[model samples]
Target chain A: MNYPIIVDVTLREGIADPEGATIERALPALGFNGISHVRAGKSFRMNIDAEDESSALAIAAALAQRLLSNPVIENATARSAAKG
Target chain B: MTRIGVVVFPGSNCEYDALGAVSALGAEAEFVWHSATHLDGFDGVILPGGFAHGDYLRPGALARFSPVMEAVAEFARAGGAVLGICNGFQVLTEAGLLPGALQKNRGLTFLCQPTTLTVESTASVLTRDAFRGQELVIPINHFSGSYTCDDETWASLVAHDQIVLRYKENPNGSRDDIAGVSNVEGNVVGLMPHPERAMSTLLGSADGRVLLESFVGAPVGAR
Candidate 1:
């Protein structure tokens, strides 16, 4: 199955988001109500074909290590979904 | 027979390009892991680009204490020619081989874009074969490249022609548009761009060759 998976690397929960802080300052009267905390992150979407979910997850992990992201500031995971 | 060494830390990503550029110009480049202690005799050293140690604390902050940097600091003190590219530049500063700190870009973004740089001083070892004020197009990929220095340091850099490369348009909010700088002795040089990445038009423009070629193009002792 060919499906797209995304990896988002932003600050974890309870972490201060400077980027979010800047955006929140402008959101009060701009029609974005009830939006409290906002953070930014890198997104990666790719298609992979694997015999099983484990193999697909393994591939994702390897890609993340090799080039998909910088492991220092970024945390990542492997998520797979079957296409209809 | 000019032997060059490319220092490789745990997270360095541009050693391959540095080796390629050196080998393409008919020199031998050996990879020196950051864990090593001593830098054996070599013609020159190129601290090629990459996010060394992941820039965890600060760009080059932790990398300064790496074992191999001791040798690099000694080599520069002895007047060996060294050039740091991008993160390599940060490491050099952290190691105290050069001065100043590279802070987060004022724009607060991971800027990866093609940039323009002007050759500020042709008299330095890295640009002695070229004409000053020559502008070249190259690529810059960095998050914390804003160069910060005190009033005295900035004045000295300007007075001694220590700046060899200045950005044509100040891409990183660096002080005085400093794309690259050299030491007072002209033996150590560092810049915040990837010259090796732009050595060929196939990768992109070959304008960077003008700078990288300077390392191997001339005699060892002359500036």
Candidate 2:
């Protein structure tokens, strides 16, 4: 079966996020208050042909580790999409 | 004379500059397209500056999968000198030949201009002839030039003397002022500054000659 996968890549905690910081700074002035933290990340959605969801997740995990995210400064997670 | 290959991606803008700079040093320089699968007869390979693959999905992410990278990786393994400048540096990190990643500048600004860099270690093939701590003025132009790495990797890089050039002024807020690094074998090097843009005194600094000359004169198959 083909399973849908979602891969999320984000900067690790303590790593500088200048793009996130810039957006966070803009939020307060635009009347969007009470938001303490704002971090930016990327998400990729794809369908993998595998035996089942678990196998698809494993393939997604490997893809996330090898390509979707750079381990030096970023972390990645893979999950099966809810609808797919 | 050393024959240099300047790898050219579709979006590469500085291949000609790198070609001119290397050729001016009396080394025969030629362009190697990204689709090429072999790097035969080239003693040095330079991934020059530019927005490869239009910097999509993050700089260097798409370009790292190009057919030429396979050849470039093979060349590095055989002890051929590989130099990655600016965006080329990003590709090297993405290709896992280098240890760190280039992030957006600390202030979220695109930086461009000349900067001073100190030669931290001459252990790399690209910097073997450079004097330790010698300063060179080179130009850098990019939005994502700040280098970031985890602590463990940073320690290993230091221990191996792979931390090559450090910015004298930390223009991009790189970790430990690192502007350049090399692999453990010293056959590969990646740096943010554009040595190709600093070849003449009229351009405000000829200090780049020190680094480029070192690469051109390095012994091949040293590993």
TM, chain A, every candidate: 0.69, 0.95
Q: Which residue runs of candidate 1 sit more than 4 Å off their true CA positions?
A: A1-84, B218-221
Per-model TM-score versus the true fold: 0.73, 0.95
Estimate candidate 2's alpha-carbon lDDT, on a 0 to 1 scale: 0.91
- Point to the candidate with the largest TM-score: 2
**Docking category for candidate 1?**
incorrect
lDDT of model 2 at position A69: 84
Q: Write the per-residue lDDT of candidate 2 for residues B1-223, one digit (tens) a residue.
A: 8999999998999999999998898899999999999999998999999999999988999899999999999999898999999999999999999998999998988899999999999988778878998999998899999989989899999999999999989888899999999999998999999998999998799988878888887766754
Residue A8 lDDT, candidate 1, scale 0-100: 53
TM-score for candidate 1, please give it: 0.73
Candidate with the greatest lDDT versus the true structure = 2
Candidate 2 has a DockQ of 0.78
